[model samples]
Target: MKIKIISSHKILYQENIISIIAPGYHGYFQILKNHTPFISILKNGCLKLESKNVKKKIKIEGGLLQVKKNLIVIIL
Candidate 1:
């Protein structure tokens, strides 16, 4: 799966990720390969990603996330 995070100033992160955990407005949620298409409003929290046995995280103030066809794009 592919993930991309962008802010008004620049692209924060972009990579082929295995899984993701995001801070949704209601709660936390996760995404993996071949998952259903989704869209959510994020709250202030960390965005976690895992790929190739490595995990990474980014702090987000708030954002929007959209997923479709194994691609995810986050705007903050």
Candidate 2:
């Protein structure tokens, strides 16, 4: 599925990915293709993005996330 990670000021990462780990307000969650739609507040932690079939991790102070139309958009 396609994914775009950003912040209030700039885009962080945009690409196709197999999975992602995000720090949610309640806790951390993982998203994969065809995952259920959701909107959640985020927390400070490392975000793991499995892009090009490789897992890459990025840390953020946290913000929000929305999953819709098979797309995952994360805001930091």
Candidate 3:
């Protein structure tokens, strides 16, 4: 799946990821390949992204996340 993290000033991240873990308003949630489409409110926390050969974590203040067609978009 593909994931993009955008902020008001710039695009923070855009890459193909195997999976991702994000901080949702209710709790934390994970998204993997071919996951169902949905939207959620993000809380101030960390976003973890994983790929075949890479793993990363990003700190976010808060944002909105949308998942559709194997694309994950997060706007801060």
Candidate 4:
């Protein structure tokens, strides 16, 4: 899936990925390519993204997560 995260500060990330792991308000969750459309709120925690080239980790404050049409968009 293509994961994109935007914040008031800047674009945290925008890249192609095999998976995206985020800290959901309830708990941790993973989103893969072709993930069903959905939206959620994330509490303070970390986000993990994996790709062919490298794996990434980023800590986030509260934010919004949206999945649609094989795309994951996050905004803080």
Candidate 5:
């Protein structure tokens, strides 16, 4: 799956990832490749992204998340 994390100022990150863990309104959740479409309000927490060879963690204040057709977009 591909993901793009955007902020008010610029695009924070973009990459092809195997999985991502996000802080949703209720709690933390993980999204994997080919997962069903999803949308949610994000809370202040850590966002984790994993790829073939790299793993990253980003701290976000709050944001919105949308998943569709193997694409994930995070607006912060």
Candidate 6:
């Protein structure tokens, strides 16, 4: 799946990821390839992305997340 992290100034990160776990307004959730479309308000926490053997974590204050098709867009 494709993932893009965007901030006010510029694009922070954009790449293909196998899965992602993010902090939602109510709790945390995970998204994977071919997952159903989703949209949610994010909370202040960490966002985790994983692909193959690599894993990455990013801290975000709060934002919006949109998942559609095989793409995930995160705005912080």
lDDT to native, each model: 0.95, 0.86, 0.95, 0.90, 0.96, 0.95
lDDT of 4 by residue, 1-76 (tens): 7888998889878998998889998999999888888999999999988999999899988899999998888999
Task: Return the number of clashes found in candidate 1.
Answer: 0
Write the number of the candidate with greater TM-score, choosing between 2 and 5.
5
For model 2, give the 10-residue run with minimal summed lDDT. Answer: 46-55
lDDT of 2 by residue, 1-76 (tens): 8988887788878988988888888888898888888998888898888877588988888778899988988877
Evaluated against the true structure, the overall lDDT of model 4 is: 0.90
Clashes of each: 0, 0, 0, 0, 0, 0
CA displacement after TM-score superposition, residue 48 of candidate 6 (Å): 0.8
The lDDT, on a scale of 0 to 1, for candidate 5 is 0.96
* Predicted structure 1: lDDT: 0.95
Please report, as a residue range, the 10-residue window in candidate 4 with the lowest summed lDDT: 7-16
Please list the residue runs of candidate 3 whose C-alpha ends up more than 4 Å from where it truly belongs after superposition. none
In candidate 5, stretches whose alpha carbon ends up further than 4 angstroms from where it belongs are none
Question: lDDT tens string, model 3, 5-66?
Answer: 99889988999999999999999999999989899999999999999999999999999999
Candidate 5 deviation (Cα RMSD) = 0.6
Clashing pairs in 4: none
lDDT of 1 by residue, 1-76 (tens): 9999999999988999999999999999999999899999999999999999789988989999999999999999
TM-score of 6: 0.96
Candidate 1 segments exceeding 4 Å error = none
TM-score of each: 0.95, 0.88, 0.96, 0.92, 0.97, 0.96
For candidate 2, the C-alpha RMSD (Å) to the true structure equals 1.2
